[model samples]
Target chain A: MNERVGTTVLSLTGISKVYGEGPTRVDALRPTAFEARAGEVVAIVGPSGSGKSTLLTIIGLINPPTAGSLLINGEPVITDGVAVANLTTMRRRELGYVFQRSNLIPFLNAEENVRLALEIDGVPAHQSRTRARELLESLGLGKRLAALPGKLSGGEQQRVAIARAMIHQPSVVLADEPTAALDSGRGRQVMELFRDSAHAHGAAVLVVTHDHRTLDLVDRVLEMEDGVLSEKQPA
Target chain B: MMDLAVRDIRNDLSRFLLTAAGLGMLMSVVLAMTGIYNGMVVDATVLPDTYGGDLWVVQKGTQGPFAESSRVPALLADRIRAVPGVERTRSYMTLNVQHELGDGETLRFMLAGLSWPDDLGNSLPLAQGRALRQPHYELVADRALGLPVGTSLRLGRDDYTIVGITSGMVSSSGDPLVFASVSDALRIQNDLASEALRLERESRVSRVRRSEYGRDPANLARAGSAAPLPVTSPPPVTAILVDVAAGGDVEAVKASLLGWPDISVYTIDEQRELLVRGVIDRARRQIGLFRALLVLISAIVMGLIVYTMTLDKMLSLSLLKLLGAKQRVILRLILEESLLLGISAYLVALLIGELAFDLFPRRVLVQDLDRLALLGVILGLSVAAGMVGLRKALAANPNEVLAS
Candidate 1:
């Protein structure tokens, strides 16, 4: 990939997520520590009910971990149990998320959907529109700029969603089964896009997936089963 | 925020427009009700306005000619004219009678009797023909009576020709009015059946003949006996309408009339107050109650629509939260959509209300003040409706998107 792993951009230490208390208590994730450096693509693979999605959510700053600390660029943003005051700000400015179904706003077309992410960061409308077009074009969505989510194919919709996520140039891009809704060929294209995005933008990219056919596109792969994580050798 | 709302509405334009039009029709009815109330007030004051009299003189301790049976001597018109500052006086008599159209249809009309020439402004202005120039058997009918100017109608023993047609001359109860000469009114008021008159005369003559004077001619001659006795006594006129000279003191004239023995006087203001507070009070209350109920219903409907729309977009709202759109942004979007719907509906209601005026059976009076007040009410209602959706939006959880 001709990319050197830079400083750590996302770090999770002793993180755990518990559903309830007493007898009915369940452990969604069991005390996990993970780090991903800039210019690196990391994948967590597991079957249903594994803790892959849980750990990804914790690093994405969506749900606070039960007992853990989160550090961004080596700065503590969550300690013990409390999230910092700037968690939302950090989430908006530093973290990008791509979900399983693309989850694009149905009313907005591709260009507008991508532009919204930049506009949320207070970017000017003209600049945001320009940057949105550029990002979509780089993802090979230039001709479908005005196509609504409903009009786009499944693969095209996912590529538009990827453009939306990367338009803001966030420090970390977190994805959860983004290729689950696509075929193997489209899934490979999406995974390769993520690898290229991570290397080209010098951002940390983490993905949770069950598909093993596209494992070679990621720099490192981690396996999770029964709420536990183990480093795995790539096939 | 507006862009989002616009796009959303455009995507479902038909549904949104239908909902707004439904609300608009309801609002139109509400506005029409207000106009109806105003029309009632207008109807009640039409007489006082057309009278052009500074003061009204009627029987002692009576409200006025409209509220009660007021009887005053016809001669009192001259007496009122004698007072200083009195420019003119007219003996005014009013009564309700049914005119048979002869095809099994009868229409009730209020008959107004005043002096000919009507110099004191006691007659309604003509819209078609000349006013009553001849004294008797000539009438001026209001256009609402639907009588042509050349038509003739019978009241009692006489047929009167409709000489003039006036518009908007009606009683407090919305009955059409007909103006006739004072003499015709007196005869109509005092007219009795021939058989009844004959029987009454016979009874009187028999009583006189049976007395001692019947047997003694010498005493009868000394008593200045008459061969016949009068059969009927004329009924008293209704009231005396007095017009003061221009720039004259109405209170002074009213005070002078108040000193008389069996008469009451009312200035124009008192007459108006009596009509409004006395005759229109019940109607106003009923309309007010209806307006309150309608406003409440509109508010509830608005809230329901807004709440439904918010629930429909629950997933989108949750995703926006996950995408880091703040609570305020979501709230603003919902509120903007609500306002857009409300304003559109309000405009539609106004347009429909204006068209409905001509269709109402009674008069519908639309005033600018009423329109402005309704606008304020609608805006307030829109904000209140928006609050319902805002509550739902505020409770949106970002974590829900992750679970989905």
Candidate 2:
């Protein structure tokens, strides 16, 4: 195990979300407490409307929790339900996300799509290009760097998305069903990439998925039910 | 950073260029409207500019010869010459006439008369041939009339040869000007049909018999003669153009002419202003309103186009925002694309105008300043259109990328 595997990089305490008011009020999350340490690939699995995505959104910093203290890299991001750190800056510098689909800009080539993340962080063009090429090559996409998203296969596109997510070496990488569109064999490959990203780069990888075939590749599995979250033991 | 706007355009170059071409055609029409108004002003003032006179003396209380009718005594030129600062004077006459072209076509023109032996239209810009050399049968025709030099035109009872051709010499109303001697113009104006003359003679005979000399056969015979009676006084002229001597004050000469209660005097600049403001003011306003409306339409259409384009990129933009792309970065992308579209459309408009403006029936004077001003307007329009797209882009929900 990597030495950084024991360090807690993301922490969420008593985080909950509710919609509307009065009789229309409904709980989306039930005071969830979770920690994702560096060099750990954690999976959150649940059926539809089970609050898994709600928890993911909160961890991704895309939605503010109704009540919570959230921290990243030992710094307070959201304290007692009030955001103390700039959310946009933290999202840019410390957080990365991969969606179900590749979500690459269609007009840009594969390398350019990956380079866009670094470019958004104000990286120099030449340096970003070099890093983007290296990342894509490491993801087995060196031959397809000049291909647009439309020309790349589903598995190849997902790999490019993974490269894009890891380009800035973010502390926490949130993925929402990163392998849902791939076949079982290709799905396992992508899950393995998440494992590699966590172990080699010391990133706290959290994937929200329904795919079970790749669950064995993850370090831990957390299951959600009825807006409640709990750890599930291996069979 | 990579130019996101340019990359998008290159990815869909054919569609982008087609859109620009459509916008270019609309912009060309807007430019043409401006040019037509400019052409109208130039046409209204061309005569005054070419006449190069210091003052114009017309009938009192009237804006003569171009904007309104003002007929003064033809000999008024002589009286105007007596002013202290008046260096020279020429009798100016104008009449609108229509002649059959022998092909079911009627040629309508403005007949402008120049004083022969004194003013043979030497001041006119002759594009071909020479000015009127004879007092009775020579003419100077504007090129717009489509009459070549040496073409003889029959007016009234005489045939006049086109001796000179002037280009761009049209009246305030856009009618081509045909120049002739004062004598020939007056004869054409006064020429009467034979039957009308016969009736007038008989009426004169009856009036003479009814008078105290009713029984006098000599007076009856004189009235009944077959020969046409001679006019007792000369025909009236439209106005008198005056030139002031060097180191002379034109206002003083104009004031002296204004002293005559029967005539109105105006400086050369005032004459041009009368033609522009009095003669073509309504037309200018109409064209101006049309130009303004076209600019507004261009803005609206461009805005809608930009909005639609932004909608097309909604997903991609959402993904970028979700990836922590700055708001300003996305704004720059939209603004740059809008500017690029506007600039490309403007270039296309200029090309269309250059190739096609002359084909218009009326003169289209596309001035450089007008082009520069329009470019500024297009830039403004581009920015405005970009704002429409930027609003949509900024409101894009980055969470939608996750949903998708």
Candidate 3:
């Protein structure tokens, strides 16, 4: 894990988001510079409506930043506020996301939920199934593979979500309050999984969370107030 | 690749199957309407098709025997037979009568004169018994009338025994057809109750007393008696069916008969056209309108169902989009689900139609072409319905997943 610690996996320079024009204009996210290296977990904490979700959305490539240069694995995906490459392909091959709710597709079982990510990337069914089973087993969900999201508990569901995110071996994994629905113990377990995913798998991890009980599990903490972001060392 | 559509359907199979079943019931109605319309066409043209005559002669300026009222002299058959190129001619008469079934239940049917001894209804499609042998009391009844062979039915003061059972034979109005000899049909047409005979005799006597014949006591006395009045000539036949000699010019024969000035001639095909296009045109329109409305209703229902199912899966779709799924993936999911639902419903409709179509009062002829055409329509409708859900799916914001 330490061998790949210094490798830069994600970089954003002067990233900002503005919603409207004239008086109706609102700054959802202010210009911010940030980076996460392999084998590291970075946590973003802020009050309600403090642009944490906005920042996460931009980093996830779900929404375009108004002015920014963004790079993943040393390749420029966005430069000078314009998408230089296909954002969807970049997201599919380079990024993974875990929402506040596990957001597991209700119809698909735990194993299928993880397999779908690989399928979207055009992986063959046998390889995808093998990879999904291995990943779910590593996440301690082997027995619950055929169980649907509705049939699983909160922690089990989040573990399945983590397996789904890690199945594609994306360079960066972003979580927006992934443990908001889980209890304290389950939330801590989920944070430890995120840490292991970053440290062991060499993926750059960023999480937006209001819960501070799991703060020590992260390597760095970034605080956001209104539309501005500021970094602080993890306690 | 994983079949996301199939996975979703299996997740909620009961509801999906139930929805398909409901839609199938509606589609079955549409199929039934199409079948009824086809049956009507068959019923209207069956006689002309089965008669296999090359030409028909009817009263001038009339469509006759099936579509309009026509009365040509019974002797017109002899004249038509003498025309050039005419090989054979037979007198044809048809009338609708209500026959009592001995239990106060009346069966209304169209009684057609077969010109027996000349035309014994041998050309009719007999499903069970023999053709008419005796001209007077023998009848060939359509199976739709539910009269078995050898069953006696009372019609116009005479009991006629069912000799042969014809299948799928009906009038333009969908009433069953019963064939009897021309003489028996004529007698049935002319039969009257005893009170009506007395009234006729009194009227004839009064007419005789007022004329110059009143001075003759013998004529007056004979007119006042209960004895039946002497017949002047045989009853007029409805029309004459003519068969042209093989290798003969039917058009020339028709032209020769057209010169009579009192009768009109038509080729068999023309007579069929008159019956289909003129006799049952209104019914066709009515049934066609119903079928169109049913199809429209089915489309609307299918659209609503697909839209609602999409609505239920909006979050899942947004999640898939956020997970970097291409737009076409989500579109395929919705479209595939809609298509499966439609195909399943169509199969169910076929099963229902097979089970219930024969129970309808009118014959239901479900032709293969009609079935294939309807399947094409259903496929088209399913795709069109899928569009309703696709619009909503494509518009779903992936950012919603972040908020969730």
Candidate 4:
């Protein structure tokens, strides 16, 4: 395998993003460069209104960079730092995301919600349901399979979210303040789950968090300030 | 994934149940409309069938007995009886009148004058007691009137005893029917004031007095000088009731009666058509409108629900998008959710409709065809609602997941 492909599941070379035309324009991210590799856990930590969310959005392909190229597994998907159309398909097959509040479907139980990710992919009912149970059990939620979101605790819900992200076995998982609703202990436990999921399952996991107590859980950490990515410590 | 619609439903039973309950009420109304229509059709035609006539003989060119007034001499039964196809014939005097029960509750009733004797020896299927056999005083009433047998009622200035009560024999207007002997029927067929009868008697006396004064009452005035009056018998009944033979062709018999009088004839089938086409059309149209309105409201509800659910799961949608879940998949999930809700509601509505019908006096039919049609409508509506959610999901940006 090529070094670029193995070392980086996602590599953004000098990406910059700006909103609007002239007077109302804003630069949410300015010439940021970063890479996330397979089997590695990374956190993007920043305070509120520090362009952290904007940076995360750009990396997640929700918004395009104004400049720079983005490559996935050594394949260039963006050129001149501008996204081409048809990005929706590219993101779905390659990426997974976790949100701050679990954001689980209230109508669906833990297993069902996780199963929805597979079902949305056109997986057969039996297989998807089976896989959902497997994932939930693996996440230490074997007993909460039939329980609805209301019945599950904050930590359990996030664990379900993690299971859903990995259910499709995507190469990359993105988390946006995944433990914001959890207490310190549960938050730390959820962070460890992501770390273990990435390394043991060969996934590239990028988490955006405000929880610094579990910073050591990640293999590497990326800090952004006014839209620039800086490496703080080696893996 | 799209199949998880059922799974989701199972997971959140309470939410599903509440939605179904609301939906069930709507369905019940729909079913009731169908039942009411059936009742209307049956009620309007039931009277024509009871008369046991192939055709009605009336004054020409008018729909009589129920819709208009028609009168012919009571003697016409003789001529009608001689018709070739009229194997057996009977005369009757029918009138619609209001009677105040002993309890002071007024109800409309049909006064029937029966002429011919039957196998029961001029009797009827009575709830209690016997048939009206006496002239001017005996009466037979329908059991629905809640009147007791052997009771007496005042008809105009005359009092008559209720000798019997028949079950299920009602007029077109839901009035209870009463049977009186032909003599009494003809007597009160046209009621008049006591003063009017006395005045006519005094005129006769005046004629006798004038004759004694040596001037003939008829010769006392020129043709234009005096208001001329003629002595008359009571006006004949409006129409006669005849029972056609079981094998008799009603249309054929109806054609024969068309030649008899100043009235028009109507068969039971013809009566049904008139009711549906003339009187009941407007109500049917109203029901159609209500059905459309209900469908529109239900569709809007589904759209709003799916959209709200989508908004709640925006982050998850973006995540799915990032993981290469197709737009179609997301769209399917939204649609599936809607369809699930619709089906659940549809079933609930039918159940409620049936239960309501059991308790209510009015008719309500929850037909299978209507239920199937509702299912189709709900499925289509849900699919539309899902599209709204799909649009929202597709609007989510995966880049948000990567943000710091």
> What is model 3's DockQ versus the real complex?
0.81
Over 4 Å off, model 4: A1-7, A75-89, A180-185, A233-235, B2-19, B26-34, B100-108, B118-140, B148-168, B180-184, B188-197, B203-234, B240-263, B266-268, B275-353, B356-404
Predicted chain A of candidate 4: TM-score: 0.91
**CAPRI class of candidate 3:** high
Residue B388 of model 4: what lDDT? 78
Model 2: CA > 4 A from native: A1-6, B200-229
DockQ rank, highest first?
A: 3, 2, 1, 4
- lDDT by residue (tens digit), candidate 3, B120-168: 9989999999998997998999999987998987777888899899999
Give the alpha carbon lDDT tens digit for every residue of B245-292 in model 4. Answer: 678776777777776555566765665566566766777788778877
Question: What would the per-residue lDDT of candidate 4 be over residues A88-157, giving only the tens digit for each residue?
Answer: 6666556677888776767677887888777766688799888889878888999999888888988998
lDDT tens digits, residues B260-297, model 2?
Answer: 89999888888888888888899989988998999999
Supply the TM-score for candidate 2: 0.94
TM-score (C-alpha) between model 3 and the true structure: 0.95
Best by DockQ: 3
Return the lDDT, model 4, position A111. Answer: 84
Higher lDDT: candidate 2 or 4? Answer: 2
Q: Tens digits of per-residue lDDT for model 1 on B101-191?
A: 8887888888878676654223566789878778888888898899899998977888889888998777777888888887887777677
**What is the lDDT for B257 in model 4?**
74
Model 3, stretches more than 4 Å misplaced? A1-5, A20-25, B194-230
Q: List the residue pairs that clash in candidate 1.
A: none
Off by over 4 Å in 1: A1-5, B119-127, B186-191, B199-234
Provide the lDDT at B32 for model 2: 96
- The TM-score values for the models, in the order shown, are 0.91, 0.94, 0.95, 0.79
lDDT of 1 at B354: 74
